[model samples]
Target: MISWDKDFKIYNFKSKYGPWALVAGASEGLGAAYAEALAKRGLDLILIARRQEKLDELSKKLINEYSIAIKCLALDLSDIAHVIEVLSQIDLPIGLLIYNAAYAPIGDFDTIPSDDLAKVVDVNIKAPLLLAKFVSKKMIENKRGGIVLMSSLAGSQGSPKLVTYAASKAFNAILAEGLWSELKEHGVDVIASIAGAIVTPGYQQAQNAKKAPGTLTPDQVAEKTLKALGKKPTIIPGFTNKLARFFMGRLIPRKWAISIMKQNTESLS
Candidate 1:
């Protein structure tokens, strides 16, 4: 585990962002990593995911380790209404919102089932967008809070085999960019972590090949992204991913970049 860098970011997290945080998709992998990082920083957490057992286990572990209050809920993020209903019932004033859940269907766009694509839209696009809408107003009222939307480096441009997933991620980054500007003046921090590959359990299940270059651990990405929260609209965690974004976004033709992505994501197909 990468230890927190006090020298790098010294925000009085509890004071500036309130006492409580809510992490959607908090059952495992990157989502669980985000929950851990925040828990270590002394924030009480409201953990949400689809698995009740996993949420219960995680809540027990975190409460044991950090001695912080926790509330765990099992619900599908795709059902935005149920999620909102649950959120409303929580008496705690959640000051930090982390939307880490995403549905990524990896294959040629046309070959993939329409229902899978629709699931992607509901989970990846609708959930985060609406959660941000619901949470940000309270942040604006409190005059300080944060929102972190997980995106991907693949979302920077059109990735062939990952078309639907990439497109959905692109929606998140753009949403965060717009909200960062609109919400910053209200003292609410917003950032999109346009991350590269991470060695999470979900990633391992999906990937058939060896670890990709510059693959980071979930903790590393979580730590770096949280550190960068109030500082930028978006962060690509790894240096390799940052370099990739620079070349793809600034140093090449659009067609050339897309072609590069085709080769890069061919394995995913």
Candidate 2:
């Protein structure tokens, strides 16, 4: 069990980081949960996603419930230039940035279209790189801030069907770790959240199943992530996930790890 102080107050967040946060992929699932959690912590938000209606609805709900400021940008992360432009216009200093947008294309490497592969790289890797560059500059200038990059267990090893997706997440994880080392001296905290399976709409759609064993709820993942921010360079959300990663990365041979991962992912397919 991953335990934290149940009585830990949200004020600690506001005091350490600033009063505003930016959350990408905020329409649903873990992104939405992050937005809600930040609101409860008394931070205004800038929400980005592809769905306009969903963004509007979420903005209204959070504003009504939390009474905090919110700006919704219904933009696709795949559009790199437009995403940069939109972010450039945010007048508020973003104290925290959660790069949660990702695309996972599951299939044989050759069976997947080239365009689909490019799109995954664009959203999962390029967008985060650009956004982090933009936000960390401001955070560095301010002399204090936080960033959370949403990575996955898939990033740790070869995933047969989720090749490009896993590779992209590996990029995210390594990027965040590098930034953490560089930024910590400047008073900015960076964390790569190595998540396991979570019960989100996106997960359901990707797996074409109702639920996966050992999966966590989106809220559980978000809350835990928020609590752990700025405390570590990387975090694996669940105890089971932590154990699995340790054994797979250390205890077994590289060939055996890849083979086991292939078997597990093939079962999902």
| TM-score (all chains, Cα) for each model | 0.94, 0.94
For model 1, residues 1-269, the per-residue Cα lDDT tens digits are 65466622434877777588999999999999999999888889999999999999989999999898999988999999889988888768888999999888888878999999999999999999999999988889999999999999889899998898999999999999999999999999999999989988778877664688889999999999998999999999999989888999999999999999898778763
Tell me, by lDDT, which candidate is best. Answer: 1
lDDT of 2 by residue, 1-269 (tens): 63355325666788667678999999999999999999888899999999999999999999999999999998999997898787787677799999998998888999999999999989999999988898889899888999999999988998999999999999999999999999999899999999989988888777554454558888889988888888899989988888889989999997888888787778554
lDDT of each: 0.90, 0.89
Q: Which stretches of candidate 2 lie over 4 Å from their true place?
A: 1-8, 208-210
True-structure lDDT of candidate 2: 0.89
